[model samples]
Target: MLTKRIVPCLDVNDGRVVKGIQFVELRDAGDPVELAKVYDEQGADELVFLDISASHEGRKTMVEVVQHVAAELAIPFTVGGGINSVEDMKAILRAGADKVSLNTAAVLRPELVREGADYFGSQCIVVAIDAKYDEETNGWKVYTHGGRKLKDLDAVEWAKEVEALGAGEILLTSMDSDGEKKGFNLALTKAVSEAVTIPVIASGGAGNAVHFKDVFTEGKADAALAASIFHYKETSVEEVKSYLRKEEVHVR
Candidate 1:
């Protein structure tokens, strides 16, 4: 059985980790390098460092910050935000990112995904879709630039498309559930997981251990990611995994 992964995200803005509701009203969380070390010591399966504002600010990812965070951790690290081209991917990888997650960049130039996959292999290409429920469409719509821009792309279709383009995984974050601590968006996660063959990491709305269980068992996500809950010392990764183990969910 493949063990489910528990990942903690560091949403960095202006060099500090921040958390917000529905991708707005940001609040400070902690230092990315410190948080990365904490999560690594806590046995987190992977650490995701997202420079949440870089894409919106029209800047490149913080290579120095990536190097700092990566140097502190002994686990896999994924760096994202403002990754626009093959050169950007190489830079992040060279700076010590185990994987590169593409959001707005991939949406604007989808060829980046194919090119990244060809150059770095599928395992290094991660397509992260930030989505929110659309009232008009009555389904999740993909958003970019930290959920500030609404695109006409369908979440499910995008999931399939990225996988077809050689993306090794999909990081699906629910704008509605983000920073709410209610729970994961199970329906949205299930839909995306079913739409793609590669692993899906469910992001947003994880308040408790049960939320992790729900996402892995009910949402069918291969991994579950949260920020504030773990950052604020609300829940520990060990506790989450212990509960999942009792629920017969495979977790590392």
Candidate 2:
């Protein structure tokens, strides 16, 4: 079986790492570069840096911040937020991200996905989907602009669409569950994972080690990403990996 990846996400704003519940009420986490080094040292499988406010502010990701964070890690890094074109992707990649995740930009112009995959390889392209459950839709709806805008797109269908458009992976974050820390939204994770063949990195609502196991086993996620837990020293990456190993979930 493929080893499930445990990723630490740095939700950065103005070059500082921050975390918030349901995508609001942001709190200071730490310096992005410092947090990146700590997670890398703790054996994180990968690191994701998101300039959470960039898209909403109409700008590109902080390349300087990305470069600093990238310098601290030996593991793969993914960057997202405010990437609007192939040139933007190039800049982020040049700054040292192993992959560039497109959220708002991709939704606005989905052909950008193919454009990026064609310029880089599919492996370098990840589409991030922020989803919130909608009883009116009878499923989850896609959110954009740092989870401030809701789109008509259905979360599961968007996953398949992006996969077909040549995105290498999906970063699925549940806005409803984001930062709640009770547990991941397993049902939503499972739905998106099963809908697409590409790897899915389930995000939001990761509370503890057992939450990781449940997401891997029942949610069928290829990897899981969390922020506040690791950011605040609530749990270390090594501890989570140890717990996963005990539960027979493969980890790297």
Candidate 3:
């Protein structure tokens, strides 16, 4: 069986790790390099470093910060935010990110997805979809610019398109559940997971270990990511893995 992964996300803004509710009202978590080392020591399967304000600020990802964090981590690392082109991906990769995630840029120019996959192989490219539940359309709508802009795109359809365009994985974040700490959006996660062949990393609303079990089993996410819970010591990676193991959910 493939073991489910537990990833701790570092939402960086102004060089400090931060977390917020529904993508606003940010609170400082800690230093990214320090947090990465802690997570690595705690046996986190992987770590995600997102310069949350890069895209909105119209700048590239913090290559130096990424390098610093990557240097401290022994496990796989994924970097996102303001990664706009193949050149951007190359720079981050050269700086030591195992993968580069694209959000607003991918929405604006999807050709970058194919171009990135071609240049660095699909495994190095991750397309992040920030989605909000739209009651009027009765579907999930894709958002970009850190959930500030809504695109006329369906989340599931976009997931399929990204996979076809050579994206190796999808990082699906539910804008509705973000920082709510209730649980993940199981319906949204399952829909996107079933719609695409590649792996799906479910983000948002993970408050406890049971939530990870639910996403891995019912939500069908290959991995579950959380920020505040882990950052604040509300839960530990080992505790989560132990809980999942007891629940008969395969985990690493």
Candidate 4:
């Protein structure tokens, strides 16, 4: 089996890392640059730095912040939030990001996904989907604008479309599970992962190493990402890897 990836996410609001439950009640975590360095040292396979408020606040991602964080990382870095055009993508990549993740922008204009892939190759484009279960829809619906606005799109279908649109990977975040620290939404993760040929990185609700193992095996996720647990030092990346290794899960 292919090695599974354990990633730590740094959600930035006004340039400071923060974590919240179900996308609200935000609490400060730490400085993004310092957190990035710590995760890199902890044997994280990759890191994600999100300008969590950029889209909602109507501004661009802090390029300087991304540059600073990227400078401290040897692992691959993905930057997202407020990227709306090819120029935006180019700016982030030039700032030293290995991949650019799109959520609101990609949903607003899916052509941007293809445009990004055409210009930078599919390997560099990751489409993030913020999904929450809707009883009205009887399925998960994609949310945008940092989980503030709802889109009339099914999560699974959106995942498939983005893959066809040339997204290299899908960063699937469950709004209902965001910062729950219970476990990943296995049903949602598995559904999206199976719907696309691209790698799926399951986000939100990661509580422990067993949670990571479950997401990889039962949820069929190629990668599992967490924020609060890692940020608060509830667990370390190396510790999780150690547990996964003992459980016979492939890891780097």
User: What is the TM-score ranking, best to worst?
Assistant: 3, 2, 4, 1
Q: Which tens-of-lDDT digit does each residue in 86-123 have in candidate 2?
A: 99899889988899999999999999999999989999
- Model 1 score (lDDT): 0.86
TM-score of each: 0.89, 0.91, 0.91, 0.90
- Candidate 4 structure quality by residue, lDDT tens digits, 1-252: 689999888777776776642222223235677767777888999988787664533234467777887777678989887789999899889888899999999999999999999999999999999999999877999999889998999999999999999999999999998878889999999999888899999999988999999999999999998888876778889999999999999999
In model 2, pairs of residues that clash are none
What are the clashing pairs of model 3?
Answer: none
> Candidate 3's residue-wise lDDT over 1-252, tens digit each?
889999998878766676632222223235677667677777799989887664534234377777787777679989898888788888889988899999999999999999999999999999999999999989999998889998999999999999999999999999999989999999999999999999999999999999999999999999999988987788888899999999999877
TM-score, structure 1 vs. true: 0.89
lDDT: worst 10-residue window of model 1: 20-29
Q: What is the Cα-based lDDT of residue 239 in candidate 2?
A: 98
What lDDT tens digits, residue by residue, belong to model 1 across residues 1-252? 789999988877766676642222123235677667667777899988887664534234377778887787778989888788899899889888999999999999898999999999999999999999988978899998879999999999999999999999999999999878889999999999998899999999999999999999889999988887876678888888888889999877
Candidate lDDT scores, in order, read: 0.86, 0.88, 0.88, 0.87
Q: What are the runs in model 2 whose C-alpha is more than 4 Å off?
A: 19-29, 53-61
Clashing residue pairs found in predicted model 1: 183-205
Cα distance off (Å), candidate 2, residue 90? 0.7
